[model samples]
Target chain A: MSLRQILLVLKREYITRIRSKAFILATLLIPLGMVVFFGIVVGISLWDSDTEQTIGIADRTEVLYPRLQEIASERYQNLSDLAEDSLQALVQGEEIDGFIVLEETHIEGQKDPEYISSGSGGLKLQNTLRTDLREVIRNERLARADVSEDVQKIYESDITLTTTKLTESGEETEDDTGFLTIVGFIMGAIIFGAISGYGGLITRSVIEEKTNRIIEVIASSVKPIELLFGKLAGIGALALTQMTFWIASLLGFAAAAGPLAGIFLSEQMSNMPETAQTAQAPQGIDPEMFSIPAIETSLIIYFAIFFILGYLIYASIFAAIGSAVDSEADTQQYVLPVMVPIFVAYIIMFQTMNNPDGTLSVIGSLIPFCTPIVMITRIAITDVPFWQISLSILLMIGTFLGTMWLSAKIYSVGILSYGKSTNWKELMKWVRQG
Target chain B: MAVIEVKNISKSFGDTRAVDNVSFEIPKGRIFGLLGPNGAGKTTAIRIINHILIADSGTVTINGYPVSSKTQSMIGYMPEERGLYKKMRVGEQLIYLAQLKGLSYEESKKKIRYWLDRFEAAAWFDKKVGELSKGMSQKIQFIATIAHNPDIYIFDEPFSGLDPINSEMLKEIVIELRDNGNTILFSTHRMEQVEQMCDDICLFNNGKAVLNGKLREIKQRYGKNTINIEFEGDDAFLDELQDVRINNRSANYAEIRVLNGQSMQEILKKAMNHAEIYKFERVEPSLTEIFISTVGEDNINPKELS
Candidate 1:
């Protein structure tokens, strides 16, 4: 097998696929779509947070009116002694977001205070109301008991726990489990999508050549193994190009998201401060989460390695399947067997995310078929043992070589043998003959 | 000197022996024809010669070098199932194929232009192969086959999809290539094409060469034992003929193979008694007849032979 010939085939495969509209659309559209989708989601959440609600309170108890007035800020409207019918009219007219009825029995602590709204209030609003009412009630009780203000202030102080993870060397690191899980999930998805998508490209390319009978002209010139390698390398390059675009776009979005979010928040605040303050603070995903992870270099490098090896192995299998069949429809039987391992790996991905260092994750990471996705997740979540990473890499390369050998053997025979569908027995026969 | 020499090559797939003990020689600067019916292993033999399939046993050498990738580069092969990249422009596909045959990009580009012009397909340079008519693609495929200007060419069923006009055009180009000192070997079930073109012929049946030799010598060996006659009112005399196998019989014409040392005069005497003989002549059997006679009655399909 001449390297020059292989390179020629590779050039053809690469140029044709790269120039295809489908490749261009997919490489650009998928990442753009993901960015647009996330942007809308975040924008909606922020917009919801800026919409402040006006809560009208009907304080039935004359004793509670002063406390309610003191606790109510710009967001609250104290409608003391307002009749129930008028309050209902206000709620119906959309004048007040909701009304709170503080009955006289509230002093006896016999019934819960009622808060009504057309829609459910934001969590932040609910928390703020609960805290203020509790504080006001506590102060009233404290005054009756003749407690000192200093004691009450001490009692009202808030405490928060500072969490840290100790490393193997006893260095305290910020607990980044949530952050790591998110990163691992994103990385795993990228690897999976790249492998299956590019691998499918290899399959369809092979089937196209086979059906068109171009394989005859090609097989006459280059060795079948060379053709297989050329296809794998070509499509692999295309996949890498697409992945680079996606990574760049993702990083670009992450970098710009902070300022973009700030601009959005400031605009909303200026437009409607009352709603903005009362709205629930955006939940969970901070803009800082999009910042480059701590192990970004190593993660990116390992992801590249795993992705290349994974693509080689799977694409080889797909090429072999393509050769053995005449058309895409005939691929169903063979495709399932090849895809089962990948499906298994995908199913184990969630478990790997939860416990990256668990025995299941360790085993999955070592397995050649699952290693690309599972091991990347493991690396993202925790510091995997150096030996484990090395072994996984070694096994991936070794497995790819074996698969290439097997696939080339089958492809050499299957490409020329047309008309009849090939079975496992015939494939095995070809392998043995080779 | 023989440019392609096959020595007892055999290949089998599973329980079926696709090619068995096949041996032939294609001398340089000559057109060789490989002929057989469907499933007759002609394709298998050609593939083995191209190094697309390895022989189970025996050897194949091209210009004294064993059939390897190096030798393959010196050969041009257009398979029975002709194909080109459907989405690629005709010129680009030709250049790509030419390059695959070991031509440099510049060399391929130059040759591609020459061949496209030769086939009168210069206007189709930028047309995708899928957009071309079947006959047009055949021309492009032919050009691709010979664009690298290899020493030897092998085309299987090259004229299968061509119109009669395009077929004659390709035939002329093939002959022109031979005159230019390129050794050509083509496989076809079209007997008339082979008879008109081939200097040497290897007839295959059931994975073996049933007949092999120079075309003239093979025909000469059959001798002038057949008669071609065009006559009118031959309503009953043919039934009176003995030891003769009649073929292509019509109301005004009949081809008769005289066997058992039968005399042409006896057939003539009987024919004149029933009808006026417009023409009668004893002639050597055509390649179609020789093919049928050699492959035997049991194996021959009259429709395929015709």
Candidate 2:
């Protein structure tokens, strides 16, 4: 195999593919579009949570009215003067979000207070209303028992558990498992998408060359293995180019997302009441937890290693399938089997992310076909054994090299053959002959 | 000295022998036509010569170099099933194909322009191959085949889809290539084109070379037993003639082959007795008749061969 010829073929494949509109759209526009789409979703959800609901109260007891008003403040409206029919009309007209109907039971807790609305209200609103009502009832009971407000304040004080991890050196570090899980899921999904996308590209290109009959001319000029290697290398470079773009964009987005989220949250804070502002403070994992440290160098390096090997394995199979048949329609027979491993990996991705140490996850991570995706998730969610990672990487490299050799043999013979569809038996025969 | 030499080259695809002990040598600076019925292994032989396929047993050499990638780079091959990338521009495709043949980028570009201009296709440089008519694409394929200036050129069924004008244009270019000391070999079922263009010919039948040699020698060996007659009326005398086979019989003309010690003078006399003979002459057996007679009737049906 001539290096010059291989380089020429590689140059052609890379330049032509990268210049295509589809590659450009997929590599750049799709990611940007996804970010915009997610931003819209997040912004809309924030808007939904920030808007406070106004509740009208019709209390027959007259005792609970002031207490409810004090608890809800500006969000509560007194409707005790309205008749039953008028209250119904107001509810139907949506004059308020919903109205609370309080009935008298001689100040004894005989029945639960009903909060009516057109539909279920937001979880936060329901929780706030329930807690306030429970508190008011408890305080009433507490007064009967002559308990002081200071004791009540002590009972109502919030407690937050700061979970930390103790390292082997006797130092405690903040547990970032939640953040790492999210990072792992994202990385796994990206690797899976890149491999499948680039693998399909290799298949389509091979089919194009075969159907065009240019394969013969090319095969004559260079060794078949050189052609296959050149094609893989060229498209592999394109895949890496797209991956680099995605990673850079992600890092850029990560850097900008903090400030952007700050501005967006501040805007929402200024638009809401002070009480609502406190209720809507960012919850769960801190934004800082999703930092660069979450993506360690080892994970990135292994991710790259597995991604390339995975692509080569699948793309070689795809190319062989491409050569065996005359058209895309004929690809069905071979494509399904090749896709099984990828689909299995994808189906188990979430499982691996959730329980990286589970039996299924461990096995899936070690399997050559699933390692690229599942192993990356495992690495992120938990500390994988070094031997496991190395063994998986080595196995993937071996599998890919073997697959490439076999595919090249099939491809060399298959490209020259036309008209009839070739089956696995024929391909095996070619491999044996080679 | 021969530019390409095939010695007992044989290739088999599974149980079917595509080329059976096929041996032929194309001398330097001559047009060699590989004539055969469909599926008679003409393509397989050409592929082997071009090093697209390896012979199971035997050897093929180009310029005394054993058939390999290196020798392949020196030979221009246009397959019978012609193809070009439809999405690529004409000039770009040519340059790419030329570069693959080992030409440098600048050299490919220069040759591409020269060939495209020679074919009067300068305006089509930027046009996509798919957008061009079939004839136009064929021209591009032809140019791509020769643009690298290889010393040996092989074309399998080169004129299958060409019109008369384009075919003529290609015939001139092929002749010019041979004149420039490039050895040319082409396979075709079109005997007339082979007769007109070829200096020597190999007639393949059933995976074997049934007959082959210089065209003049083969025709001389067959002898001039055929006669060409052009007449206006009374073509019934053609039926009365004994020991003669009539071919391409028309109302005004007929090609008659005499056998069993028959005389052309007697046929001419009989034709003059009934009709006004415009022309009467004895001619050598045509490549078509020679091919038919050599391969025999049973092997001539292309549809059945496949």
Candidate 3:
């Protein structure tokens, strides 16, 4: 292969895309869009915070109303004195957002009385109401039983879990299972996005040169294999540039708004089921239990290795697919089969986060197409054995070489050909000819 | 010395034979025409010579070396279907193509500027190819083909889309290239264009080179054997002519072939008595007549040519 020709082709590919209007717009606008989106969300919540829900509580039990009023007087009012008809009129006329009538059965019996309303306030208002009423009832019952006020106060306090991993070296490190899952998923998602997004870029590039008939002039100048490598490397470099830009910008933003960034991240991690509720500090537990685990230098190295191999393997497949067809719409059959593995690997990533060393995760990490995402994630969340990591890396190297060779072959012949319906059989024919 | 030599080269696409057992030689500093009708394998042969397609059998050598990237670097090739990256600026695109052909970055930039200035396309340097008109882009494609300053230039149907003014201008530059000792090979079905430019001509029909020789020698072999008759009368020509083939018949014009064997006086006198004759002369066979008649005859009897 002529490295010079490849470099020249690569240079052209890189410069044009870096200067493209789409790249510049996306680079500048995506972060701005995110800021605006989050601002709207935060703004709506802050506005909602000011509008308090006034619930007129018609307490049948004279004992509970006084205790409820003594607690949250702002959200609850005594509707107990009003007639039922008048209470209904108050809710409909918007005098009160909603009202709850406490019947004698509710105070003495086991039932939750419905809060009749015009459906103005949602679940959050109801959730807070439940917590307030429960606290009032619990306090009254405990007080009547002659329990100490200190015991009641201690009962409602936080209890958090602290997990420390005992490494083979006998070093105690914070077990960052949940936090590490987020890191792995973020990196994996970047890989997945690069493959699909930059893969389309490569495909569209191939189609552009082919359909425009520029391939003929290029073929005469350089070998098709050179063109193939040049294109992959060029676009791959561009993808890395875009990814790094986004990540650096994200880090800067996080540093500038440290506390808010923490809240946003924890909010994202809410679904991961962290042991401690971050909104409140634990009474006596170590705060490090909620700390984000440091992404180690070795883990970053593994990420780089898997990410590069994964990008090459999938990018070559995309290039081959692009060469085989004359237009983007004609790429359906080839694109679908290639996407299935990535989609499957992504679905299994969530499962891997929860159970990193599960059989499915191990098997997925061994398979060529799914390996990069699953293995990196598994390594992040838990300790993956040396042999498995080694085997995974070796398998990835083999797949990348094979994919590069195969795609080059298909690409060389397919670009010169035009206006034939390309199928699996036709593709194979091209491979043989190539 | 021969700049290019193809010996018994043949290529096939599945069941279809695109080029079959074709061979020719192009000496340095000469203009050669690869002449053929549509679908006659000229493009396939041109591609094979450029190493864009490898022949199924036989050899193609450029300057005594087998066609490879090294030799490809010495050749500037423009394919029949001209195209450039629509989104790329003219200057950068030319530099990119030049670099691909093994020119260094500095050399490419220098040459690109010179060629753009030469073509009067310096203003188009910053313009994307998509913004240029068809004829203007054709100039850009030409500049790209030649800017690298390779040893040999191959242009397929280079004169097809050009207007007469630009066509004449391109012809002047081509002749200049020839005078500077660069081998030029271009293919065209337009015999008229090749007539003024080619030192030698190879005529292709159905993937076979049926005629190959020096341009003058090929025309000379057919001899001065046609009478051009342009008349203004509707009166029918007397049907007393014999042993002479008539062609290019029209209401006011006809090419009567005396064709070296027949006497022209009888046919001239016959036309003279029948209608008002404006012009008549014994003319040597034009390349168009020779090509048509030769191809027509080749189609029927299929003579072996070397």
Q: Which candidate would rank higher by lDDT, 1 or 3?
A: 1
DockQ of each: 0.77, 0.70, 0.77
| Residues A202-269, model 1: lDDT tens digits | 88888888889888998888899888888888888878887887778777777787767766665666
What docking grade applies to model 2? medium
Candidate 2, residue A183: CA error in Å?
2.1
Tell me the TM-score of candidate 3's A chain: 0.80
Q: Model 2, B206: alpha-carbon shift in Å?
A: 2.3
Question: What lDDT score goes with residue A189 in model 3?
Answer: 75
For residues A114-144, what per-residue lDDT tens digits would candidate 2 score against the true structure? 8888766778889988887777666665666
True contacts kept of each: 0.80, 0.74, 0.80
Q: B76-120, model 1: which lDDT tens digit per residue?
A: 888988899999999888888888888899999999988888777
Candidate 3 C-alpha error for residue A136, in Å: 4.6
Instruction: Return model 2's CA RMSD, one decimal.
Output: 5.4
lDDT for residue A37 in candidate 2, whole number 0-100: 97
Q: What ranking of all candidate models by lDDT puts the best one first?
A: 1, 3, 2
When 2 and 3 are scored with DockQ, the better candidate is 3
